[model samples]
Target: MQIQLEFPAALATVLGMRGLLIDGGGTLRETFRRIADEYPKLGLHLFDESGGLREHVLCFWNGTNTRWLPSLDVAMTEGDELVIMQAASGG
Candidate 1:
């Protein structure tokens, strides 16, 4: 399936583009792997040294945080949007 990726300007600067479309995977993990393969630099900001998602990074699948989903193994559908953003915090 084709997945639409959206990112903030800061990240877009890092990625050298505003967004992208990629052949998604059966599972979110697989999608991430594909993204890593296509954009290793962007992947660095998304994953930690141990290959875990960075604490500041949030991935929203179809407007829902996958972390609250029953599983990250959720399958992708055509036109599914995966939005990547950094968490915000302030006093």
Candidate 2:
């Protein structure tokens, strides 16, 4: 299976690309682990010290926020897209 990844500009700079295609199957967590393995620097920004996703980072899986998902262990299908964005804070 292949998953698509979309990153914000800041994070994209770390990976040298705004979008990517990665071969992944199984749980979402496992897919992320693979990404972390390949792009450690981008992973730093995606996950926090506790190995959990950062509060300020938003990960949308197939158009739905992963945070709102029942579990990170949710199985991902081929062509699923994961978009990473930094949460906006202000007034």
Candidate 3:
């Protein structure tokens, strides 16, 4: 499966800028792992020691945020767009 990855900001060096077209498969976690491999610097900005999402980023599959999903176990379909955005902060 192919997923469209959109980066919201100037993130880690591996992410470069703009978007990325990546292979998608299995679970959402798997997709993240693939991205991490493609962009090594994203690992620290997104994953924890337990291998889960870090506290500062939110991911959306299609138009739905994964936080509302059954779990991060969501799978990808061909041509699905995966948007990775930096968490909004500041009060």
Candidate 4:
């Protein structure tokens, strides 16, 4: 399915764009894998050395935190939105 992807300003600054449309898989994992394959630089910021989401990274599926969801394997359909941002923590 085709989905819309939104990146945080910081990440977009680095990538030079804020959002795009891409063909994604049924599951989030596969979508992320396709993203990593298509944009390794952006993937570096999203995934850690172990290929897992970094501690500070947050993923939202249609405004709901993926962490709160039952699984990242949740099926996605066309027009779904995936938002990525880094958790903010500072004084």
- Which residue segments of model 3 deviate by more than 4 Å? none
Tens digits of lDDT, candidate 1, 2-90: 99998888887886897899998688888888888788988888888866678888899999986788877778889999998888999
Q: By lDDT, is 2 or 4 better?
A: 2
Ranking by TM-score: 2, 1, 4, 3
For all candidates in order, the CA lDDT equals 0.85, 0.88, 0.77, 0.85
Query: What is the per-residue lDDT of model 3 for residues 1-91, given as tens digits with 9 covering 90 to 100?
Result: 7788886666635566678778888878789888877776766677778667777778788988877888777778889987778778897
Query: Which 10 residues in a row give candidate 1 its minimum summed lDDT?
Result: 44-53
Model 3 residue 45 lDDT score: 73
Tens-digit per-residue lDDT, 8-35, candidate 2: 9986678688988987788999988888
- Maximum-TM-score candidate: 2
Quote model 2's TM-score: 0.91
Q: Which structure is stronger by lDDT: 2 or 3?
A: 2
Report the C-alpha displacement of residue 49, candidate 3, in angstroms: 2.2
RMSD of each: 1.3, 1.2, 2.0, 1.4
Question: What is the per-residue lDDT of model 4 for residues 1-91, given as tens digits with 9 covering 90 to 100?
Answer: 7999999888887679999798976688788888888989888898888776788899888999877887678778888999998888896
Candidate that scores best on lDDT: 2
Error of 3 at 82 (Å): 1.1
